[model samples]
Target: MDLFDAINQRHSYRGPLLADPVPRTDLRRIIQAGLQAPSGRNAQTTEFIIIDDPVLLAKLQAMHPANQAMQQAPAMIACLIDRQPAAVYEGYNFQIEDCAAAVENMLLAITALGYASVWIDGWLRLEQRADRVAQLLMLPTDKKLQILLPIGRPAEHWPQKERKPFAQRAWFNCYGAEETPCQ
Candidate 1:
């Protein structure tokens, strides 16, 4: 699929994923797309840990009680942010912004590659869930787990989610000025 089509079609998939294994080449391509996202001051604090091992996947599934998507997904990408003091830019931490960009890029790539995934955040960020997940992945102390993406073929077809009308959410020049819809 083309970039525009991929963007339009991409949705958060929380349903079951097929049992088929995702090829390593495709996984690498998806990761590459994420790495290409722009970073703040070239801090490049975003890191990814690809999980495909069945045993490890099972462990991860057990770790996240609120989410079952990982239980069936053939592969997952753990988005991490390096929180070292030196990783900051302009006296601010851009880990969230940087990682979000990477996640969006990977989501589009996943769509283009004929697969589905969900950008999981809140579930992993609750309480000490992320910390436990980081431990399961054996991530270092400085590496903070921010999001998880489960990748695989969807077991059931899903339609794009309904979005707010352009006019309701967007404006021309000012915050509440004349509405200007995208062409």
Candidate 2:
């Protein structure tokens, strides 16, 4: 599918993914797509840790709450940032922005490849718990774990989510005013 088609078709997938392993080549392609996303000052701070080992995946899955579906995913990605880079700037973490864009690109690519994915933020953790997760991953004390993404072939079909009419969400050169769906 073309870029536009991929964008339109992409959505969050939290259901079961096929047990089949994602091909290394395809995984590389997904990572490449992420790298292609724009970065802050070209900082390109995002880093990806793709986890496929069942044992390791199992361990990580155990760290979370009752999310059986997470254990079933054939692949998972840990989006992280180097604190050193972000520290160079005051109140700016380019890695988070960079990785987020990267993940968005990968999510779109996943749909294009007839797969599914979900963005599971690690933000649900309290400070202490979040720190534990970082320790488990052996990330530096300064580095941060942005999110965990589970990806695979969806076991069930899902429809597009409901949304407010475009008119209600858009505006004309101002906040909350007249604007048509097509502009």
Candidate 3:
């Protein structure tokens, strides 16, 4: 799919995914897209753990009860961030921003490749889930697992949700000055 079409079609797919496995080559391509994302000061604090092992996926599913999508996905990508201070300014860590950019890139790639996925982050922040996931992946103390992307074909199609009108959400020159929508 074209870049603009992929962007327009991409949606959070929380429903079950098809049973077919995602090819390793496609997974690599998706990860490459994420790795190419621009990072703050080129710190590149983001890392990925591509999980396709059935046993491992089952364990992760057990750990995150709310992540039903992960349970059915043929493959998943765990997005990790290095907590070690890198490109820090005024005691602010840019790892979150760096990882977020990477995730967005991967999401776009997933859509372009005719696959479906959802950015799984909120569950990682709840009930010590991140800590448990980190332990399951046996990550080093400095590496933190922050997000997951379950990749596969959607079991059912969902219509794209409507977005706020461009004119209502965007402006030009000054805040709320020009309500003209982008062409």
Error of 2 at 85 (Å): 4.6
- Give the runs in model 3 whose Cα sits over 4 Å from its true position: 88-92, 179-183
Give the per-residue lDDT of model 2 (tens digit) for 26-96: 78778888889988878888887787888787777776545545767778877777757644366665676
**lDDT, each prediction:** 0.87, 0.75, 0.87
Question: What global local distance difference test value does model 3 have?
Answer: 0.87
Compare candidates 1 and 2 on TM-score and give the better one: 1
Off by over 4 Å in 2: 84-93, 122-124, 127-130, 179-183
What's the residue-level lDDT of 148 in candidate 3?
Answer: 88
lDDT by residue (1-183, candidate 3, tens digit) is 899999999999888788999999999999999999998778788999999998988888776556557778889999998767665666677888989999999999999998999998888888888899889889999988989899999888876689998879777866676656444
Candidate 1 global lDDT: 0.87
Clashing pairs in 3: none
